[model samples]
Target: MEMENMIGLTDLLAAAIRAWKQICVTMLVFALLLGGYQGYRQYKLATDPENSPEKIEERYQAALEDYEKRGEELQKKLEGQEESLASKEEYREESLLIKIDPYNKYITNIVFSFSNIDESAQLFRYPNTAADYLPKKIRSQYLELWKSMDVPRDLADGRYADLEWKYLNELISIPALEGELLSIRTMGASAKDAEDLAGAIFAYFDGHRDAIGRSSAAHELSILNQSTKYVIDEELKTKQESLDKEIEDLKTGIEDTKQSIEDLTEPEREDGYSVTAIVKSVAKYVALGAAGGLFLACFLVCCWWIFADRAANSFQLERSVGAPFLGAMKPSCPPAERLAAAVMGERRWRDPEQASAYIREQAEAGFPKEGKVLLLSTLPEGKAGAGMAGLASALEGYAVTSVLDALHDPKAVKAIQDCAAAVFVEMAGQSRLTDIRDLAAQVEGAKRPVLGVIAI
Candidate 1:
């Protein structure tokens, strides 16, 4: 029973195997179509400048050169000043102060007025008070009093005398003090004495002259420095503008060149030939289109094979156990065999008993009873043999018995041959079995009269 079931299954799988070529060819066709589509897409993308590595590299180089040139020009324009003003630490400190109170009037006013002021001068006159001349401990009290204006330092005795003579001289030299000093000199002081006093005052003022000169010189130098920066900045701006224009022109030219290349060497259409005849001529020898066609054809053949395989498997399962087999067919083979079978009413027999009776009648009509011992056989694992055996057993006056346990016992074939009219049933329809024609010859050539044979 297990053997019969396995034989049925094997017959089914063998039919499917016979159709494997068609299935493989179909799959190959689909694979080729997919591969062709991908190849065409790649070709189109490559023809465009944006996707071409060489073109991309060329554009990148041009951009890099432009950037480098701009950097060099900027460096030359702001040579010395860049080092001083471009320090990160200076910018960070300035940014911190700005963040504290962006609209604080005192800070805004001071920074705006004195951003260019000498650092030393700013430190010395930050408070701008007389307390700056006093000792630190005493200066604090003086500063407190000054803020309150409780005791005016100008009205106090010895305040005028204690004033630094250099500071006092600076006050005296003011244009507003000229007339008052002249009146004081005329009021009873001698010319010589007045002159000496004025001279002493001038000397006192001269002692503090270093601070004024340094402040004035620094301011003038800052102005000169800014004027120079303005001139260089303008020159650099003009150069940058010129370079920008040139770069634009070059980019336009590059784009035009790329467009021309695309127009001249565009990708081909689905027919596997380029639009440009010149390109096609050069590339025709590569046989790219032929290769693609071959792949598509094979794929289609594989699909047909798979479809046929499924049909064959279904046929095996649905077929009745007593049905007679038509001859095996292949798409590539000649149709003569099928035509012959059809004309003889042997294409397929639905009733195995009718087929067996027909065979027996034909044999008895032609040959003697001594020649009726027909040894019918099939390929190993073939259902055709079992069907034949069943038909043979149903024959009149013939005691038919099937012995199929030979798979385990090699000598079983000899043991079963003792019967007067024996039909040795060999399996069939498996891919690895011996050739049908070869097995037929071997069985029929035996001394027994082999009447008829069938393949699953």
Candidate 2:
């Protein structure tokens, strides 16, 4: 097969462009439908209540009011607790209510000597380092502790205590502390757990305190001198007593300010999509849909054009029949004027330069010389006769004769024999190669090989 017959790159591209043009109306319809769908989606999103900016702000306002209401309730609770010296002891007793708290069972703990009990030696490092030094067995103890607390131990389920412990380990942070003080602390799944764990850790540390003390005393005496200790203890006791009322007032003030600030500030809904952003997204979708629709139409049309054995351009027609293609006839040209007038303009039926070239090439290909007759014949009928006549007029000294409907009529054979040689004229793009081959066979059977073909 010829390269063009096998679908060369240039031929495929031209067919694709032509196919796109042929199916342009369908492509436009698809594009319009896609664009309309995109527009509708955007309209729905813009009008939807959940996405509406007004509804979002209303929800935010409602949430703010609810938060304020909660803060007000907390304030009432704080106010109900009296701060008098008589009530001070009672408040301290109530603060220890974690003892009865059911959630305390989930507690876990670690205690470190925050102060340098041995004045000659460094004590605990940073809290992070301390946390890192915690035994792996202790870290994993949350599971056993949670199981003992009568919580679910179905570890496969995410809501169970074991699952909670797994995630909580990642979220838990070892808080930093300042200054030097002997502090026992605890933390766990809940605040009540933390409080209970702090007490447990204290008990645990106290149990080992004598052992720790003996070890520290080996380096240096941990206990201060009696006189100095007495003076420091008394001074600290007096200072604490003096500041108790002020500390209570500051605590109340801090709580009130924090609650008020939380109620007054509006939290931003960062997850919400803006109208401008949604519109831009919709526009992008619409553009992509339109482009995709157009490409799909082109691709479908191109596939059909390629598979169907039809000529898309002059080159394909030439290569398909392995013939010299003279020229092409524009589709817009009216077939009435033999399609020659469109290329020749107002000049009646003839193109001088084109006709001269056609005649010269025919003469070079062994067309009989001056004063001989050259018969013009065409397949199917006289559709190309006018163009043939025009070319014949430019045949220098040879006189041209034509047989209309020559391929289908047997009487036309006599006319071919009367002439020096026969030339076949074909309408480009409209005529098929098989029909031309059949016409050539008829001429060859009649003992006159066709000189050449002129495509117009």
Candidate 3:
């Protein structure tokens, strides 16, 4: 078995473009053949007595049932996920009262003395409207005021920014107002968090005490005591964390199911088949045939290009020498061009003047003075020399210093060391990729640039 050779993407791409019209033609031919075959088949199927309207209607009913069944399943799954999430959230809120730590580990309490009417004086007296009524009303008002307190809310946002309002509010424990003595407890992530929050609450009552006394029949406001307490129940934090993770996972599942529902969307419902339904069916099959043909044609073109021995295009020339491909210049044959259009498409056309000018400009630019641009070929030394001479004699201004078989001529290696750059002259259907590669390696080894290729 022979060793395999490496093929470049440049080779495959150029080959495809060079034969685009041929690929298109192949697809057209296959499309016509397959479409005609499908048309005949569809015509037979249309006339078949087996496919009565009743059968087609039955097919529609079955498809509709399947669609509806699938939709119902998705809706049920979505509802189930929603219900589960809501139930878990409700449980989570209920547990939040115990879940949010007040002082993180330690809690603080501050006490205040506020004056209110002594109800002991009315122990023996019947309920009186004057003293009894006003004091009772004042007590109720004070409770409401504490319920709507904003000190804790402000502290939650500022000093204890990590704690949510609900959490911070939960962390604090307040007693019902009854007499002169009032105590408020606060807790947080650190002892400082609790102390700061307690201070803020105390400051609110102190600053607003006179107003509170006037509004609620209270006398004095003072901090009587300050104490710290420890909180127990390590499991509350763990329980809350577990609940949060579960809720998040459920949400992700719900989103995935939504995507699944979208992907498995209900199929379209078809109406009854018509008298000309056979014609429509035939056309649809023909379109499918054309699409199939295009796919196969591309597949064949790719395969042919991969295994071909010759580096036929300018792109491959560029890849071989790792240099800029100036362009390919070859004399056009009318018969060959015509045959190519009928078969593949002739190699992509490039104007000869543009091709030659590109070579000259690049060759001149590579070396401004006293530098030869070596024109190398795969042919024998005599043949290569004669070919270049004939080109110079025929073309008005096209010139070559010399032509040498870079792989065979000993002088070619020396020239590569001497010349500024080189260009390969590849004869159509003759220059092997192996020969070009060998010559390219020699040039590259000598550190000389290969400008590009010229195809004769």
Best by TM-score: 2
Better of 2 and 3 by TM-score: 2
Alpha carbon lDDT of residue 320, candidate 1?
16
Residue 308, candidate 2: Cα error in Å is 3.7
lDDT of 3 by residue, 272-321 (tens): 34547656766777677777776777667768766556654444445555
For model 1, the superposed segments whose C-alpha errors exceed 4 Å read: 1-48, 51-347, 350-357, 363-378, 382-397, 402-412, 415-417, 421-446
Quality of model 1 by C-alpha lDDT: 0.36
Of candidate 3, the 10-residue stretch with the lowest lDDT total is: 340-349
Error of 2 at 224 (Å): 57
User: How would you encode candidate 1's per-residue C-alpha lDDT over 242-266 as one tens digit per residue?
Assistant: 5456545555555554454444432
For candidate 2, write residues 135-180 as lDDT tens digits.
2222223223333432224222233343334333322223322321
Q: Against the hidden reference, what TM-scores do the models get?
A: 0.27, 0.41, 0.40
TM-score-best of 1 and 3: 3
Better of 1 and 3 by lDDT: 3
The TM-score obtained by model 3 is 0.40
Using TM-score as the yardstick, the better of models 1 and 2 is 2
Q: Candidate order by TM-score, highest to lowest?
A: 2, 3, 1
Deviating ranges (above 4 Å) for candidate 2: 1-4, 18-20, 54-286, 311-355, 369-389, 402-420
